[model samples]
Target: MLDLTKLAREMQGISQHLSQEAVASRQRLELAQQHLKKAYECQQEVMERQEKWRDRILFANATPLEPLNTRIDIPVPPKVHTVIATDGSQIAPNHHEIAYCYLLNIGRVVLHYGQNRYPLMDSLPEVFYRPEDLYMSRQWGIKTEEWMSYRRTASEATVLAELVREVGTGDGGLGTGRRKTGDLGSREENNNQSLIPHPQSPIPALAMVDGSLIYWFLEQLPVDARDRILPPILEAWSQMRAAQIPLMGYLSASRNVEGVNFLRLLACPHPAPDCVSYCPNQLEKVPCKVFEPLRDTALWTTQLTPGQRGPLWRSNNRILELYADQTIYFCHVHVGTEIARIEVPAWVAENTAMFDQALGLMLAQVQKGCGYPVAIAEAHNQAVVRGGDRTRFFCVVRETND
Candidate 1:
């Protein structure tokens, strides 16, 4: 029950504020584009450019994009593939309820595409009501929403990794075919393969995470929670890696500026040694300032065609500092009018065959959902806890306690 009259008036005021900001943002975007044009025209010492003004300039310090691959329009080859996607939703603890409790729900969908379309889905909800679960520590305070978010992410990673491990081991009742290298060739081929310790084999399946592989929420966790949560996630990741499961994190509507940052590197006016410790006065002359408000997608919108993917760029997040082994590289994919960012680990990113398959499957999934990954969309649909269900859940808890 909101006060409709007051709400309408407040919305009107908020809309006006947004309108003004939108106007300013457009002006800034235009200026940024102008600077980008000039910088591209004078693309000298591009690799040597430094991120000196990263702090002073908003959206600065972006690594200039180096296109490892050109715009590719590989059609989605007709293949029977297995795609598993997982998504999670959480309900923060409500103090008004009978017990201090929170709920985490995870939804997963496994789809087999080809002659017979079979979809297997599952939803799991874990309710936390114990005193130990309600609070982080007696001395610290109650478990904050951030703690709950970390739990949710860890749960997501666990589910994804476990699914990958199961699929990798040729279990989980999935309809994927595990093709051994020896099946295709003769004794000489067998001799060639048997000589190597670990031969390159195509993974039978792909595991799709609903978000980025890098856990940003880890940056905010308390020491205790941080220590407790990361192990399971990393172990699961290790299992997936050992099994050679190809995993991709898909962001349907990404607002990433990695491309923009890359453009900034290209725009650095001063050459190397001087640019690294560039002063404010010299920074003012840098060209990338023109594209401040524009995200990587904005630049790639016109640059890529439908189903075409842009180059891979390394992420610069501090969280990535520890994950160099699983270094993150993202590519911009043209999904109709929308641009999607697909992030993959170093194993998948560096492997040409795996990269192409991931990209193609992603494109096929996007087409299925019109603009987004259909597997993720379906998983979300299954995972979402409706408002009515939440109200009823709390009501049932209260009645049971009574």
Candidate 2:
């Protein structure tokens, strides 16, 4: 009853199927290997090209660029002296989420204050970037669309106009451009359109906007808006004489050693000896040495009190609490021979009371035996304090001016 020929045919059919599957698998494996090889080759080539570019940029001993002479030299006008310090904060719906940006512009005036901080002028012309305009599409990865209505509101413009009117007004009355005319004899007559100059006030209307948003808005503004807004600011600066009040700007940096090393590598051609053979596993054994005399130079060092000594020595927790106001304190050790220009923050400059109580105490120690005109720079320069809370304070001191 056993059919040997049929059984032989079935076994041969199974062997053929297995052979076909094995060939298919071999083809797939070869394709994967080829793709991996191509990727590795591309990555290696890119790395080599980047290294060459880096060497060319870093190694070249380029001379410092001369200051540009394109700055506009407007004549200084005679007017009343006033210091208008304007700070703008871009606040979102929720305080928990990160803000787009915050900017502070402080304009100082040496005018006599009769009643209050500078006599109560009718109004002050304050220019600020609208919060609604600060809805940055780049943050949310959205593109600005042409079809969308991209114009500022009438109310917003009115608010700015009112501010200007108040600031420009004096004992005589509100400055020109305060009223709307009616149609007379079926024709609208241009009557009170005149540039009435403020006699007592020569202090240019100081307007500090939040970040670079003002520049963007300027590009989109109508010719009329641009004319109205810019004049006051330019006049204010002209009156103040750009040299008098120190105009401050902010730049940020990384706190970690790796970040500092990368910056040094970018700035100069000299490769760090320890960084040449960097290994994550050998980090513990290798004693980390600060390279680049200019950047690596520690400006100030505060000795940890007996109570805070243990935590102060730890790597990340090196910062010690100095004052009761909760300002974080850390000892900075300056080792370089050359004097470094340090950048300070706005809060330290504006809030003399807090600076005296908290920062002044710490800086007092460093100022001892040091020459006068010693600059005490703040560490995180770009950070802007929006709210009244003094708890959220962070500071860092950089060795270089840039």
Q: Write the per-residue lDDT of candidate 2 for residues 127-233, one digit (tens) a residue.
A: 12334333443343332221011221121222223333344453211223434311100111212212334456333332211211112243444555444444443
Residue 378 displacement in candidate 1 (angstroms): 0.9
TM-score of 1: 0.76
* lDDT to native, each model: 0.66, 0.27
Which ten contiguous residues of candidate 2 have the minimum total lDDT?
309-318
Alpha-carbon TM-score of each model against the true structure: 0.76, 0.24
Model 1 gets an lDDT of: 0.66
1-402 in candidate 1: lDDT tens per residue?
A: 889999999999999999998888778666556655655555444444344444444432334344333577746644867788889887777888887788888776777665253365766677777766666543344245666667777776666665565555544423222322111111111111111121134434677888788777666656666666766666656666787667889986777776666556655464533444564454464554555557767767756888788766667676666664776777888888588888887778778777788788888888888878888988888888899879977988899889
- Which candidate leads the pack in TM-score? 1
